[model samples]
Target: MLKSTMNQNKVQTLKGFRDFLPEAMAVRNYVKNLLIDTFETFGFEPIETPTLEYSSVLMGKYGDEADKLVYSFTDNGDRQIGMRYDLTVPTAKVLAMYSQTIPMPFKRYQIQPVWRAENTQKGRYREVLQCDIDTFGTNSPIADAEILAVINTVLQKLNFKTFTILINSRIVLNNILKACKITEDKNSILQSLDKFSKIGQDGVTKELIGKNIPKAKITVLFKYIKQAQPDEYLQNVINQLKILGVSKNNYQFDPTIVRGLDYYTGPIFETVVTKPK
Candidate 1:
């Protein structure tokens, strides 16, 4: 009955969770070390934040999908709390609470685990670690460029290839969304549509229609997004804005991008792998 006993004693992992053994842990540590070294070389200091934060602190920040995915519950003290969803929000809170002590134009790198209740799939996990380095107090484009450059250099060092960096500003997207006649209440609809790259056009279309967005508008929005290269796309967007007489320096029409979260007030970027995954 040894086999029966072994079967009976087998422990099941929770859904959307995983267990990494020693070799996996070693690989993770190695990668983390490389990231740390790169960030330090660029003069970013390290910072740590707690895993659990009051739910109110993170509320109304990361948009609907992110809000839905956050691991939140009432604690023993009967307080609503959540596991950290991303480094950026926590960083913002830290700055708000400890601004007096921290240096201006603070640059910090945080590597930590974030929890989300998303569907589990390859390269996507409900719980995953993020390697984040952010500079607050300075809205300089130079800081943006530096972050991009550091990411590129580090990824190249790791032998990653055939990747494209997509960058844009949320201000630009807000203008476009208004131009498209999509309501603010439907921002999630746009964000969901942006997932077309990962989930395919048909899947995204289904999601949008499911949200009751009109089929014709969705069709036009997809076509408009697909028409031009990065620079050309920005120019086209500028032309459209000029026609509408809306003047804004921040809303650049960056064609290289597909989608990003709502909380990114300024520059937002993503690196997409062009080669097979």
Candidate 2:
């Protein structure tokens, strides 16, 4: 009876969380190792931070939408804490704490699991592993170009044949907002614009209109953005990529590639598989 009861009471993983059996774990480990090898080849050192942090450390860092997704609670000691959302913010705090000790232009890689309170979707989860490589303390365009090179190298090593890296700058989008005379909150408009790829032009227009942005302004914004070209700084980054030998076929300028994250200041990149879904 006890054995039958135990079998009946077997526990399963929570929604949006998963358990990996040996076969799945093996593949995960192999891919992680490959990523580490590629990052190290580009001179990036690994670093790690705690999975839990004071709520104060994370709040007000990733914007309002992201803040809502943070898993925060009061602990037994009554100290508010939150799970790690991404590696970038913690890495920023680390840089601030160790600024005097760490050298300039610090390049580091971190691969860790992050937690978010996201609604379950096909592939979206409350907990997901993120691999990040970041360079700090340098404003040089070469560093940006090197990131593109590393991306190309890793994709080629992974044997992905037909993928395109969409590149853009938030600066360009912000300038567009100004040129369009958009008096509404820019983040709101940009958030909708960021959905262009997922929802397409008509969908984004509907979203913007729902936000009460004038239709005329939306039209002007669309027309102006279509005519917008890469500015001098972005062109310089592209030139550096050519000098670094990253394939020109692998990337292109995309004004519509505005990332959803609120922290992106300069260039941003997203890779899409063209040949496969």
Candidate 3:
């Protein structure tokens, strides 16, 4: 019995996670250092938050999909706690707490591992590293430009050969919905639209219909999504990034790339690796 106890079966790695062997860890550290240097060049200082947060603080910040991916539990103290799903919310909490002490227009970069109880799939994981940079106290176009510039630099510096940055605005969708007279269910509409990449147009139509959106309006929405937004809106965003010296070839205005978050009120961007290693 004592021998059996001593040899209690070795636990397996939980699904959707992995152990980073030395070879991989070395590569990861090398990339991390490069990112840290890039972040510092743009005046971003590093800050960290606890992995566990009170459920009240993180409960509803993300929409339905994210809410499902959060890992929540009751700790021994009988308090509801949740693992940090992303760096954004915890940074917001920190900013509110240190508002008096921190300088206005604070710039920060956080290179941290975030937990997500998401469906494990190729290119998706339950635990992943999120390298995020954010600025508070500014609504400046230059701020947005700087972010795009930094990301473009990071990818190039990392020796990635083929990539493009896709940018879109949630406001564009809101405007389209308003123009289509879709007043009450804008949130539901955005949520459905977010699923387009994963589920395609037919699946989004199904989701919208499930929410009881009229088929006519859904048809109009697909058309609007396919059509380019007013040329002025597209050019305006492009002009800002151009002003910051980002390569025109490296970025584009894609209307279909609505980020899957209800709280995003403005521009959203992502880097797509065309040539994955």
Return the top candidate by TM-score.
2
Residue 242: error of model 1 in Å? 28
Q: Which whole-number lDDT from 0 to 100 does residue 2 have in model 2?
A: 77
- Residue-by-residue lDDT tens digits, candidate 3, 1-277: 8668656976568989989999999999999999999999999999999999999888799977688889999999999999999999999999989999999798999988999997788988889999999888887667777888899999999888888998887777777777788865677678777777779999999988999898998898788778857345445667888777889889877777777766788888877888665
lDDT of 1 by residue, 1-277 (tens): 8878878989577877889999999999889999999999988999989999999988789877679888999999999999999898999999999999998899899999989888888878888898899888874556666676677667766776556556665655555556577763556765785676678878988888888888887786666656533343334433544343333431333432535567765556777666546
Model 1 Cα displacement at 220 (Å)? 5.0
Model 1 scores worst on lDDT over the 10 consecutive residues at 244-253
Task: For candidate 3, list the clashing residue pairs, or say none.
Answer: none
All-Cα superposition RMSD per candidate: 7.2, 1.8, 2.9
- Against the true structure, whose lDDT is highest? 2
Off by over 4 Å in 3: 1-8, 198-203, 206-211, 227-237
Question: RMSD in angstroms, candidate 3?
Answer: 2.9
Which is the winner by lDDT between candidate 1 and candidate 3? 3
- Per residue, candidate 2 scores C-alpha lDDT tens digits across 1-277 of 8778878989567999999999999999988999999999999999999999999999998899999999999999999999999999999989989999999899999999999999999989999999999889998888888888888888888788888888888888888889998889998888899889899989999999999988999999999889887777787889998898988899999999887778898888899878555
Extract clashing residue pairs from model 2: none
